[model samples]
Target: MRRSGFLSLVLASALAVPSLACAADHVTGALKGTNGAVHGIVDVTGAPKGVLLRLQVQGLTPGWHGIHFHEKGSCAPPKFTSAGAHVHAATPVVHGLLNADANDAGDLPNLYVAADGTATVELYSTLVSLKGGNNLPALMDADGASVVIHAKPDDYQTQPIGGSGDRVACAVLH
Candidate 1:
């Protein structure tokens, strides 16, 4: 009986090792925006199945900021406002919203900025990464799409941009 128990323990350990290795392979990088810079990192361990994204913005004014996945990963300014609205993968009709609907694929919840001009955000979406296409645009595509922070909050549902005005900052997810 003791030997059998020992074998089971060994099997459990063996199964756990691979999971830990995969978790370690999670990739990360920096996300640059217009007014300043922010820390953007992604852990794709269970990507397409599970994903973890974290962002921290510094030197930004305190307020509610709109965050979304844009159609291009290029951050070339004039603010890159021409990156063309939030990511919306819905068929037949494309709209943008932070709530569930046929809205923008990039319409995520608001990222609150602290009074000291710092914003920290962490998001886990079932949708795949920029390249996964499980609804998200390819971040590494040729002229890949970008993740943008807007000067206003996504009004949840409005029309043509959800009234999420002013592209404040942008980051190219390469």
Candidate 2:
């Protein structure tokens, strides 16, 4: 019985070795608005399925807002257009996450802020990765990427940002 127990322990240790070798990578960035205020922080970590995101934000109008991963890491103030469009793979992707013919990899659920203008949430997406792998767009690619928070909520089925309106906050993750 002791020998059997030792063998089991050794087998378990061997199995854990591969997972340790493929440790999850991580990246983080500070979220800012057009006013240049550091209103929040965004932390991203790699996962076996994809990536996980944690956001803690404040100082907003206090309602539902659209959030997504953009194609570039640049976040010019006034308007975050410098961050570019949503991240996508080699194949052309449509805008809406709920659309039958579309569902871009960058589309994520809307974020909600309280009346006091504060929000803390964690989101996970299997469509993207922190590093380039399995044909997924790397959030930390050569050009890197940015997380954009829109002024309005995402309808999830509309075209061109789901009518989420202007880019109000951005976090560069290069």
Candidate 3:
């Protein structure tokens, strides 16, 4: 009887481990522009190093669109300046992926939109946290954060958004 009880406990523990690692938090947003509509879902999963960001977006212009996590969560539209600047976890950093000095925490690779105007991409970062602790920038901060899409592609080496034109679409990430 004791041996069978031990085996059962071991099996249960093994089974639960995978589920714990697979646990993820999700947030949804509706991207709206003056003449277009888009929707997005961001899935955050904790990893040993940092976190994984899985994004799915639909209804965007076909091409490369610059995407970043803005400071505020408000998608007020008509320019979306309310979403502040790109997120910086610790000290201020220059805005460029190719920059040797620093890169913004919110900086992500350019989102490639297909001819159908839909995209699904995955990215990882160790700068920010969804768990909201450890002095890290949380997705669910006091004012929240936002995912903004620009009209042009991010050059990854230019200053202040890589000349990505126009705030095309924005979605509040709560």
Which candidate comes out best when scored by TM-score? 2
Candidate 2 on 30-59: residue-level lDDT in tens?
999999999899988888778899999999
lDDT to native, each model: 0.62, 0.89, 0.77
Which portions of model 1 miss their true places by more than 4 Å? 1-29, 33-46, 90-93, 98-103, 133-138
Question: Which residue pairs come into collision in candidate 3?
Answer: none
Task: Sort the candidates on lDDT, descending order.
Answer: 2, 3, 1
**Cα deviation of 121 in candidate 2 (Å)?**
0.2
Indicate the residue-level lDDT of 163 in model 1. Answer: 71
Give the TM-score (vs. native) of candidate 2.
Answer: 0.84
Evaluated against the true structure, the overall lDDT of model 2 is 0.89
User: After superposition, which runs of candidate 2 have C-alpha atoms over 4 Å from their true positions?
Assistant: 1-24
Candidates 1 and 2 compared by lDDT, better number? 2
Across 1-174, the per-residue lDDT of candidate 1 in tens digits comes to: 999999999999999999887654354445555644553432223365435567767766578877776766567665776676555456534554444555456656777889987766678655435455555544445665666777787776766666767777776654
- For residues 32-96, write the lDDT of model 3, one tens digit per residue: 66464556666566555555777787777899989888889887768999999888876666887
Using all chains and alpha carbons, the TM-scores for the candidates as numbered come to 0.69, 0.84, 0.77
Residue-pair clashes, model 1: 12
